[model samples]
Target: MINIPFNKPYLTGKELFYIEDAVKKGKISGNGYYTQLCQKYFESKYGFNKCLLTTSCTDALEMAAILIDIKEGDEVIMPSYTFVSTANAFVLRGAKIVFADSRLDHPGIDEDQLESLITSKTKAIVPVHYAGVACDMDKIMNLANQYGLYVIEDAAQAIDSFYTGKDGIKKALGSIGHLAAFSFHETKNIISGEGGMLAINDRKFAERAEIIWEKGTNRSAFFRGEVDKYGWVDIGSSFLPSEIIAAFLWAQLENLEDIQQVRIAHWENYHQKLQEWTSDNLIQLPVIPSYATNNGHMFYLICKNLKQRTTIIDNLKSEGILSVFHYISLHRSQFYKGKNFNTVLKQTDIFSDCLLRLPMYYELKVEDVIYKITEK
Candidate 1:
C-alpha cells in the first residue's frame, strides 16, 4: 500500500543545477547572485517594491514587526485562528494582540467585527489569507485608513493570488498591504525547505527594510558604496537566508506557473468529486469568495463537528492517507487562558473544531484525490 502525504515539496529539476552554480560561483552566503536573482524575480513578477528572502516565515513576520516599529502596549488586531508566528511576532515586541473572529463562510477575519476593536492603542492589523484565499483587503484598507493603523498581510499562503475589487480593480494580495510575508516551506505550494520572504509595498519602508534585514546595520548601503563605512544603527536580526536555499527557491519560482497549474488541477478534482458531500449536507467545501483568486495552497473539508473530523482523520489514516487539522485558536490556548479580549470569536471556534485539510501537493494526481474521498 502507498502512503499519501498531506504535503510534499515538488522539485522542478533545476535545484541541483542552481545549487552547483552557487557553489561554483563561491558565494553560498546570504544575498549572493542566486539570492539576488530570486529577489529580482519576485520584485519584477509581483510588482513588489522590494523583497527580502528570510530564514523562515517566522523570521519574515519578525522583520515586518521591526519595520512597523511594533512596540510596548501597542495593539495588533488579527484573527485568532492562525499560526502563532502571526501573533508571536508582534507579541515579542511587547505589543498586545487583539484577536478577532473568522467569517462564517471563510477562514478570514470578519471585517464587520474589526472596527470596534480599533482604538488609539492599535498599531496595526495582521490579516492572514488562510488557504491562499485573499481577505477583504478593500475593507481592511479602508479601516486602516480610518484608524491610521498599519496593515501587514500574513500572506504565508497567498503567493500568486489576486483580489478583484468591487470597482473592478485587480491587485495582487501581497502587493496591496503596507507589508506582507510569504512562505516557501516544503508544506506550501512552493518549496525551499524552510524559506520565506518579506514583501515591502510601502515605498517609505524600502531602504529601512534592507537595513533591518541586515542586522540593523548600514552595511547594505556600504556594500553598495553609498557609505564609506557601515556600522550598527538600529536593532535588527540575521533574518536573511542562505544562497543555497535561495537557489532552490529560484528554481521553484522559475517553474511557478507550471507548478500552480498542477496544484490547481488537483484542487479542482477534490472540489468536483466532493460536491455530492456538500449537496447532501455531509461536509462543507472550501469557499472562494467571488473577489478572490485561488492559489491552490490548501484544500479543506469542514465536517459537522470535531467528532466527525476526528473520525474522518482516523479513517483516512487507516487507509494510509494523511490528513490534518490546523490552528487551535490562540485566544483559547493555555498560554492565554486568562487573558481578556474585545469580543467572542464564535466562527474561529467553529473552524478550529470542524476544518480538516486533505492531502494536496503538486504531485497529487486527480485519481488519487478521487480515491481518497470516494473510497468509504
Candidate 2:
C-alpha cells in the first residue's frame, strides 16, 4: 500500500474551464488563440526575443537544433547528468555530443571544466538547468561568446528560475541563453499534462523559429498578412502544440506565482528540517548556489553512496513513502556506450547513483513528508 507517490499532477481548477473554451472556440489546432496568449505571456514576462509553444520540450529542443543548423560532425557540449532529450535533440541532427561532468557541490554542469570540452568542432553548448535551479549562465554565456558558439539552455525543469550575475543583473534562466527550452509537463513546477515553449533570446532565430514551428512554411507570416501565400520554405516539422494544451497551460500560468510559492515553501521546509538529519547521517542536502534562485521544482538529497541511497528508498517504501532517483550518466548509457562515448565522468556517475528526489507537488503534505523522512 503506497501512501505517498513520487509525483501528482496539479490542477488549478481553471484548466478544464479554459480547455473547454479552447474546444468551443473552433481553433484548437496549433497557433490559435490560447497558443498566442501563452507565448505572449512568456515573452512579456521573461523578455524572450520570441516565444513559440511546442508539444514538448523535446520538440522545442529539436527546433533549436534545426535553427542552429547542427550538422554532421558538429560537436555539442552538455552535462551527462541530464535527460536524454538534451543530447538526443542534437544527435538527431547528426551532431556529436561531448558530455561534461556535474559540479562537485551541485548537479549542474561544472562550469570550470567546460572550457576543456570545447574544440574547433564545438558548435553549441546546452546547459540543463536541473531541478529548475539555474546553472551558472554567466560563465556558460561568456564561454559561448568567446567561442562564437550558440548557447541553448535546456531549461526543461526550470520555470520561474533566475540567476544573478556578478554584475548584479538578475536574469530569468531562459532569458539569458541565446535560445532556451521550457517544460510544462505534469512533473514540472507548471503543468499542462505535456507542453513546452522555446524562448528565442536572439532575434536572428525569431523569424525562422516560427517558420520551423509551422512545418517549414511562412504560414505564420501569411496569417499575419505579411505574405500572400504560404508554402514549404525550409526544413521543419509540426512542433507547435494544440490550443487545448496551450489553454491548460494558460490556466496554470495565470496562477504560477501561487503555485511557485506553495512549492517553494515545501522545499524550504525539507531543507530546514533535514539539515541535522542529513549531516548526522553523512548525507548531503540539495545545494543552492548563491547565484541561483530556487524555483522549488524539486527537493532532492544526495546520500553517501549507492548503498545508502538504495537503503533509504527501500526503507521509505516499506513505510509507504515514496522517493525516486534521477538521470543516469548519458556518457555511460547503453545507447552511447558503443558510440565511442567512453568518457568517465566521476561526479555525474555519483549523482546517477546517489541523488534521490522526494515527493513534491502543489498539494503535498509538508509535515507528513518531513516526519516520515526524519523519523526513519
TM-score of each: 0.97, 0.99
Candidate 1 lDDT tens digits, 1-376: 4388888779999999999999999989998898899899989988899999999999999999988998899999999999999998998999999999999999899988899889889999999999999999999999999889999999999989999987899888899889999998899888899999999999999899898899999888998899999999988889999899999998898899998988888888889888986667578999999999998899998888999899888888888788899999898887666665544688999999999999998777657656766666
Error of 1 at 36 (Å): 0.9
Candidate 2 matches the true fold with a TM-score of: 0.99
Q: What is the lDDT of residue 324 in candidate 1?
A: 96
Model 2 scores worst on lDDT over the 10 consecutive residues at 333-342
Deviating ranges (above 4 Å) for candidate 1:
338-343
Pairs that clash in candidate 1? none
Please give me the total number of clashing residue pairs in predicted model 2.
0
**In candidate 2, how many Å is residue 227 off?**
0.5
lDDT of 1 at 197: 95
Segments in model 2 whose C-alpha atoms lie over 4 Å from true places:
none
